[model samples]
Target: MEPSDLAGMALIAAAGPEEALAFIRAGVSSSPVLEVEMTSLLSEAGTARWPGLADALGRWRPRLPSLAPERDMGVMERLGGGLLIPEDPQWPPALDDLQLNAPIALWMRGQLPRIPEQRRCIALVGSRDSTSYGANVTGELASSLVQRGFTVVSGGAYGIDANAHRGALAAAAGGGASPSTLAVMAGGLDRFYPPGNEGLLRAIAEQGALVAEVPPGTNPTRYRFLQRNRLIAALCEVTVVVEARWRSGALNTAHHAEGLSRSVGAVPGSVYSANSAGCHRLLREGAAVCVTDAAEIAELAGSAGNNLAQEPDAATALHDGLGVEDLLLLDALPLRSATSAEKLSVVAGLGMATVLAGLGRLELMGLARRATNGWQRGAV
Candidate 1:
């Protein structure tokens, strides 16, 4: 509720981000100064002291009733979130690279983890009408990246974005020190957009973070959606488009990422799928490298060394490699004592034929062996 924040909200509501930055550049002094002296400043507009300020200030004057500080504060209080400024520790320094386009203040809900110096954040974006292939790939990549301790950042939309967030949530529940995912919203935090995604957005707010550049009460517009893409790009070290139609909004995010010099990646899709046209275009233009999984994306996000391979742990590796039935049969046949096939079947909840087949596979793989007692798990 500070004067500066109020001033920023007013300017943003009035002249939009680009014009607000113009006002700031033209020696507006401070937000409070602008708020109080706006009339005088406008009266003297087109003069040397306030050149190029008239148009924006003129636009701001009429919108004062709805854009005032008191109204914004009420929405903030109702939403139960706080405002983040440049001085605040949680304010992403990456955004400052946007220079004047950087938000003056961010309306935020939920918590953000301590972003590491190397920027272990990756963005997962794609078409709103994504295919199952894209959703499957996005979920796999997002969860895997979380397992590798990278945070996933995405716009809180349907299709690929929802899958990415869901994957991160699943990974976090498995228990680890990985940071939570983030969703950048185009509209005010007070009104979650895409009404269908209310449950998912609420869950994300509970488990991760929800961020918006505009103040409360602002509904999303096409212009705002395109503008918000910049925030999504600036928040992470890498931005990936999993699926995009030609001229999709995700392409906008990729452009922002490229402008920031952040790594850009695209998930390849079927040649005929329209959903992948944008990604294919990016790949063809050399705007993005073809990325398929977490390891490749991890390298782009600055994870160096030959460390992408899982660490050597024979027992764990063997366990991980087993099929469900094979694993169950292996567990049924204890390491020290072999058990009968019928007993193993009952314990593994598999049919007798399935148990026999699984036992044969395990025996062939050296994970189980036939003994006088019937079958026993392989020795470590």
Candidate 2:
């Protein structure tokens, strides 16, 4: 590996994934074997050589001391995985939307399928302790997406993530094309953090791709898991939160998707379950589209999905419960011009008092309204 690549890897190892941008802003080049003079950088942080870099470096100084770039490269080689830098063809282009916070490099195993466009990728994520309802919904959505040629992306955690990967695999086995899924991990590819998911991760590495921002041999941490959510969001064109609590991390992924201006979808669940609280919150806040099936999610990929299906005409039932007098008044009311109650009475052949009462009811029901001349039909 190049010296700059090794240095960047060690920097990520020391600073964790979140600080990649900080390292770049501090005068460290991302590649071409640029040497990072930590001693001089720290020295300058204390002096005027780099005034703004002080605060950034002081907080990170203590953490940068334990890094061993050479050793980490050797570990990665032994693991048989490879690094994916931005210049590499395998690097996901959608991540560029993250700007400075985008991953400096990805440590990947297996091969990434060729994506015609980032919109063709979808992220199906939810709570780690998902319920059966969440799992079933996620599996159906993921399988449907894979069958339609979308690549599924998710964190390699338990619950919904596991089901999503399994769904994609099942679809592929049932004669779906390749490029089924990608599992972005919170830890190094060398060690799958949730040992319980070893079998699933192995299948992914064999079928799709297993990727991480952290170097080999690194352990998973709470912070890393949170940071990994952005990758899940950025790697795909749409993110679906199948089930999550009010404070679940899956919401964080959806937020990242929103920040990137990507479409967000949430599945409704039983109102009583705390597991569905986040999805409900997302819908209520207008942060996500209430998606019930794969066809709805497929619409987000620019394909003709559920949204294209003809919907019921809301106006057709706008006057369903109105009384006969009210209906008559509404029908007789002018769509563009206004008509006085006396004129409406003559047009509908009703008495003046009855016409007045019916007009009032129609107005209240939003089927008629007072116009400049008199009463007019409401925009139902």
Candidate 3:
């Protein structure tokens, strides 16, 4: 096992899933390498990313020989839950898009299939203080999607998320009784957040799933809530924003979805409603396609012949593995004259850190290189 994998395993063994994920989310996690002993899987990305993780791991090592997987598995069995590490057959393939940013382990309750039916899942997201218009649209959309053999995925928060789950539960799954909806929680699945939605969440757990990256007993925190949005995006083939304010966290989920190359759709609400501003913004920015009804939303789920990504031409192949932002940054690099990161940032209209990160990726791909002066183009 890599030092990173050993580090994660040690953390899970010492802290349990909740603390382990907390340790990772502190910004310490790196792209994972697979070798599992996942009571805790520490990041190879190192302690600089996680901060105090190195010291904690040092303190936890003495107990490693005493670790008992069977005991932990028994505890999980009693809770009707289990841990999902990378090597597990049940791990969702869709999460692979997250690359180094993927969760170290998934703490799950209810049934998680051996392989996710991601094509049949669509995430419904919006503001917590959603309006009647948003709720009505989410409800009808969720109901219609469920009827069409699609599972509704959401954050399990109040407003739009709750309505999405309720609508799916209320719809008849003509195929038979099975999961028609699922909630990706920000906190531990052991406790449902917002308390007002407890009853509704319980129903979701009974019929579908309540999944989290953090282990049980972890409270729902604002940052955790924001971080969990990526999970919602990764779990589905399509993400639909029902309504959102200009600064709503739902926009984070939409961004993650787009990064994963999943389809994103935004509902159009009244232009006057501040809640709709985010959707309008996404439409204006071309981040999401405008979707009005269930059928339109379903079309975004996928097409029979169009599921595969279009093959890039040879000219575009040099840009392969580069993200949208990286491509933009690449355009700013000089061919013969190296320029500083500051110059690259202004030229690319990107932040310094983004410029540096993109440069690192480009360097690895042989599309960029560093010189005494700064950085310049490298052979593709």
Candidate 4:
């Protein structure tokens, strides 16, 4: 295919599989002009007719998008990160099942860790203004979940979201290939929502996946944030809420996950904290499973093998193959966990470009994973 054709495909892919298919079918059936436009492009580009047709007009159109070049790059720069089109081998197929809500393009800055095939992924969500008890409980649950090989997914907001990511990272540090954590953002990946989480968001993206449905530069509106929650509910096998007010957005996410037939889990909190009201309501309504830690979450979601344990040997081989800067960066990583590029710059005393370049190399070697917060040594 010509570059433009590929670009168009990428743009569509960024829009999510369902929407792309819907647009293509709608164009083909309702607008002869669109079909003609596509045909002309295909002919000029000398692309394979069947694959293009299948991608554009297939039954899955509602789940994908065209991902045109202009749109893709614009989204990327806006997110202050790069784009990962389906063509990128790292693209996760699990997202393809999201239908129209599936993200067409993923706005990301840090590294996307490899998710073990067929592992259970669960989302932990709660109120932005959570109580200390709620936050602490969320963190502990998150930490335990990661220890058992379940990838923890959260919104990356303050309170519960931040706690969950921290818990997962801490658990990952404990030496098993536990489930990595993921954060789905409502705003562009370039900007962290609370601003306080600028560091935390970076770490999640690097070590796991920081995903968004909107194009980069799109500041999340109330409606958009609500819409984004649906994507989170759909991506995971289950959704867990640590705390929420009566009208909390986390409840909306829980509802969406329920509608999708995904399991819903909640952590029962003290009756006094208004933040815990939502969780209590969910439990009363029979909308969620009461969970305490990673093991409980695992029992509800199942578990994966210790894939992370196998990471070190592979990382060793990969590390031995790195260039100088990469070696420097790897050396700079704290033996215990991850650190951000800015911090690494300070620790390694390297320039930003040098750090980034070295990070790219270390990422390739699988010697490190980038978290939404920063960079961390990879689980071997």
Candidate 3 lDDT, 157-250, residue by residue in tens:
9988998998888785544435578888888776778799999888887777788887666678887887789888988999999999999999
Global lDDT scores for all candidate models: 0.79, 0.78, 0.79, 0.71
lDDT of 4 at 130: 76
RMSD over all Cα atoms, model 2: 10.1
TM-score of each: 0.67, 0.68, 0.64, 0.59
Model 4 clashing-pair count: 52
Q: Quote the lDDT for 293 in model 2.
A: 88
Ordered from best to worst TM-score, the candidate numbers read 2, 1, 3, 4
lDDT by residue for model 1 (7-53), tens:
34445545665666566555544455454454343333322233333
lDDT of 3 at 62: 50
Model 2 Cα lDDT, one tens digit per residue, 121-195: 899999989899999999988888888888898898899999899988888777746648899898888876699
TM-score of 1: 0.67
Between prediction 1 and prediction 4, which has the larger TM-score?
1
Alpha carbon lDDT of residue 130, candidate 2? 89
Question: Model 3, stretches more than 4 Å misplaced?
Answer: 1-75, 111-115, 173-179, 304-380
| Total backbone clashes of candidate 3, pairs 3 or more residues apart or in separate chains | 13
Q: What is the C-alpha local distance difference test score of candidate 3?
A: 0.79
